[model samples]
Target: MYAVIKTGGKQYRVIAGQKLKIEQIAADIGQQITLNEVLAVGSGEGLVVGTPLVSGASVVAKVVSQGRHDKVRIFKMRRRKHYQKRQGHRQNYTEIQVETVNA
Candidate 1:
């Protein structure tokens, strides 16, 4: 089975034993985290979507690692002004292993 869950202001599709990177979370490696905002659940039969979220449904996962994403370059320039600005940013992220989805 698979589940749609919300965390760190984002939604992710996860299945048992799956690993995924998401926006940063305040947890250490190997820590257990339960995704409470389960949006939907799916099986070989079909899928069940919720109105906002499914009640009494959740997904459990373990923190695998924490790190930053590759740097993104931002450049800006003005025509004929001989002015330019350049910047780079790396977003933080967390890697989690989906343990199970309970619906």
Candidate 2:
């Protein structure tokens, strides 16, 4: 079965044994986390969607790692005004492996 979950202001479709990177969460490697904001659950053509959230549904996952994404560079300049700006950023993320989707 698979589930659609919400975390860190984002939504993701996940299935058991699948690994994905999400916004950094407060957990250590090997720690199990239960995501309760399940929006939908399904297997093949049978799908159940929630009214905002699915009651009593959850997704279990294990934290595998914590890391940052590649840097994104930003630059800005104004002609004749001699103004310029440059910036770069790397977003932090948590890698987790889905263990189960309970609906």
Candidate 3:
């Protein structure tokens, strides 16, 4: 089975036993996290979509680690104006292992 969940202003399709790197959440390593914003669930028979989210359904996960992603360089320049800017950023993320999808 698989599930579509929403978190951190993003949506992700995940299945059990899968390790996912998502936006950082307030949890420690090995913590059990329940994702209640289940947009849809699949059991090999099409899919069950929810209006916003499925009622009484949830996806369980275990926090594996917390870290940051690779740095992304942002460069902006304007020709003949001698205007240029360079920046870099790394977004925080959480590594979670999907344990189950309860529906």
Candidate 4:
């Protein structure tokens, strides 16, 4: 089965044994996290979607790692005024492996 869950202001579609990177959460490596804000759950036949969240449904995952993503460079320039600016940023993220989706 698969589930759509919300975390860190984002939604992710995950299945058991799948590994994915998501916005950083306050959890250490190897920690077990239960994501209770399940938006929808689906199997072979049909899908159950929530109005805001699915009651009593959750996706359990294990935190594998915490790290930052590759730096993103931003630049801005104005030809006539000779104004130029450049900046770089790396966003923090967490790697987690989906363990189960309980609906």
Clashes of each: 0, 0, 0, 0
The lowest-lDDT stretch of 10 consecutive residues in candidate 1 is 5-14
lDDT of 3 at 81: 100
- What do the candidate models score in CA lDDT, each in turn? 0.93, 0.98, 0.96, 0.95
Candidate 4 residue lDDT tens string, 19-80: 99999999989999999999999998889999989899999999999999999999999999
Model 2's C-alpha root-mean-square deviation from the true structure amounts to: 0.6
Better of 1 and 3 by lDDT: 3
Best by lDDT: 2
Give a tens-digit lDDT track for model 2, residues 1-103: 9999999999999999999999999999999999999999999999999999999999999999999999999999999999999999999999999999999
Each prediction's RMSD to truth: 1.0, 0.6, 0.8, 0.7
2-90 in candidate 1: lDDT tens per residue?
Answer: 99998888888889999999999899999999889999999988998999999999998999999999999999999899999999999
TM-score of each: 0.94, 0.97, 0.97, 0.97
Question: Tens-digit lDDT track for model 3 on 1-103?
Answer: 8999999999999999999999999999999999999999998987989998999999999999999999999999999999999999999999999999998
103 Cα displacement, candidate 1 (Å): 0.5
For model 3, the superposed segments whose C-alpha errors exceed 4 Å read: none
The 10 consecutive residues of candidate 2 with the worst lDDT sum are 46-55
Give lDDT for model 2. 0.98
Ranking by lDDT: 2, 3, 4, 1
